[model samples]
Target: MKPRILYLATADARGHLMRAQLLAHALIERGAEVEVLTTSDEGATFLGEFGIAAEVLSRHYAVQFDERQNMQRGATDGNVARYLFDPRHMLRDIWRLRRRIAAVDLLVNDSFHPALLVMGCLPGWRRKIVHVYGASLRRALLDNFQGRLPNWLARGFAAAISSELRRARACLQHDFAYAAPARVAPRLFNLPTPIALAQLPQQVQGPRAAVYLNPHFRDPQLATGLEQGLAAMGLQALLVGEGYAGRAGWTPRDPQWIDAAAHSALIVSAPGMAALSVAQVYRRPILLLVTDQPEQRSNAARAADLGLVHEVVCWSGDARLFAIQVQEALQRLRAVAIEEGADAGSQRARQRLDAWVDCLLELAAEPR
Candidate 1:
């Protein structure tokens, strides 16, 4: 019998959907039945672009962000509070999710969602639940509650987080680097970013830049500044992101973006796990466009410490200054050495994916 799996991916950014799509395709290839549910219509659209069908889960919540991509703490808190107070909507989705969970052999939650996190604590849910998220996200969560909140509230938050982690059958925390996987805890595994690449057609590195911005980045001037910076650097830029799709100089969504990025002279993107993984895998120099978001800020700092980032760009409400930073970063990145072939990085990604697939199959086959 085929192992049946349900995947719930949050749509705060496209990275979650991208990971879900990749894992869904892989599991299907491995003879498992897979169903994907996303938190928002935007996630469904993103999956649709890649020829993947997804259903939108109702009453899903997302963290709020500002126009410059800064996380809005008070707004997000209010949104969550509203959702928590709406028992009708909350219970409706929870009941729906519970039924789906019972039907599937396993439920994989990519990143975190309030509905799944709530369901995870219920009886009989842990044996069938597996959590996947980036390491930086884990760090940011810890940072949020440590010495930043009231002592009693911080402890309460920490305890809730601990409870959720304990409830999961396994936690797959992925990070950047071409390193060996390690067992961080009895049920937690620290693995390389589970990115699988397709065979690339023979192509040489070109004098072009590949750029991607998530939907959270809403500043129009940043987009304008990016163009000016690339122009100044004498590099043609191929921009891909849902946020900038219809804008002038922004290209339509291309499934072959990985190929373009692999062969480009430089890569530019927000320091999301997906972008960072791609940069490391292809051994391409990257300029990280960071914002005040804790997860992204942590990722940028870590990447720089590891010598993985070639440059870092932060917007201070100055488009001209932002452009100048980008230009200088690109110039510096040009001098860095890129490996002739990405055999090592590809191997690491493949290994991570294989490990995840193996774990899923193993869990699915276990006795109920």
Candidate 2:
């Protein structure tokens, strides 16, 4: 008999939901009976399209932002507790899922507090809580506030978030691979931003670029920059996800996104996990127009530095200069990708998932 698996993800963005879906599908393919849960109707619909119906619940996110649109660290401990990690939602979700969740043999959590709490109920069952942590809490915070905020203050916030992450058996660092070597989160393993690219075509020849935009950080200036690039090059752009100003691609549907990535010559997107994960797996050359989002900013810079991408374009001057940069970036894209760390790391993520599932099944079969 297959082990029962419950996968929970906080659908703050389509990216989180996509990761959860990918992991759940992997488990299902490995003969685990898997059920998925998310926090939003849109996320549920996304799963339904994949033929895996999902249950919805209350979720948490960062609620503190500064005047400069940066995530705040000064009052994060309290603000996160009150706003981001609201006990009321946790209580409600716990009550709603009280009966069903505890029956699962293993719980995979990607920001799903209720699943974590429920799976941690039995004496030794806490070890079955698999936490999927996106971005390194300590590393991203440090990078975001290097000279702007005092070291101690930033460290304090990291400590606070790190403490919150301790309620896991194994925590996989998604995308950025800079989790602390020891402690902080339990058994931190560096995993790629889980993308389901096993069956997709490796590459295709096309003239246009595929662009994905994050709606939260949507700026007219950035849109104009993309527009200028397209107009100058006369290359049709395929836009993905919620926000984009260029030619229409597909909605954030899985099939259309994959098709766009497979066919595009160059990929353009915010350095968010969703697009980057796909780009990493597809081994496509990319240009990132990073938002002020600290994690996105850090990921974009790190990816560019690692040679995983062609360039990071932060709009400083005007659209035309940005256009010139984009045109240059497109020209630099190699038909075949240059060898990069993200290339090897994405494969490692799949291997780790297989190992994790084997371990989970073994433990589940052991006599108590």
* Candidate number achieving the greatest TM-score relative to the actual structure: 1
Name model 1 segments beyond 4 Å from true.
Answer: 145-148, 201-206, 342-345
lDDT (0 to 1) per candidate: 0.80, 0.60
- For residues 180-204, write the lDDT of model 1, one tens digit per residue: 6787787787877776574563354
Relative to the unseen true structure, what is the C-alpha lDDT of residue 216 in candidate 2, on a scale of 0 to 100?
43
Give the per-residue lDDT digits (tens) of candidate 2, residues 67-183.
223455665545445643566655555566656656877667776353354555434566666666566333664354456569987677656555545655657666633322223
User: Model 2 scores what on Cα lDDT?
Assistant: 0.60
Worst 10 residues of 1 by lDDT: 197-206
Candidate 1 C-alpha error for residue 184, in Å: 3.1
Where does candidate 2 stray beyond 4 Å? 59-79, 84-87, 112-125, 141-157, 176-186, 198-206, 244-254, 316-321, 334-368
* TM of each candidate vs. truth: 0.94, 0.74
The CA lDDT at 186 in model 2 is 34
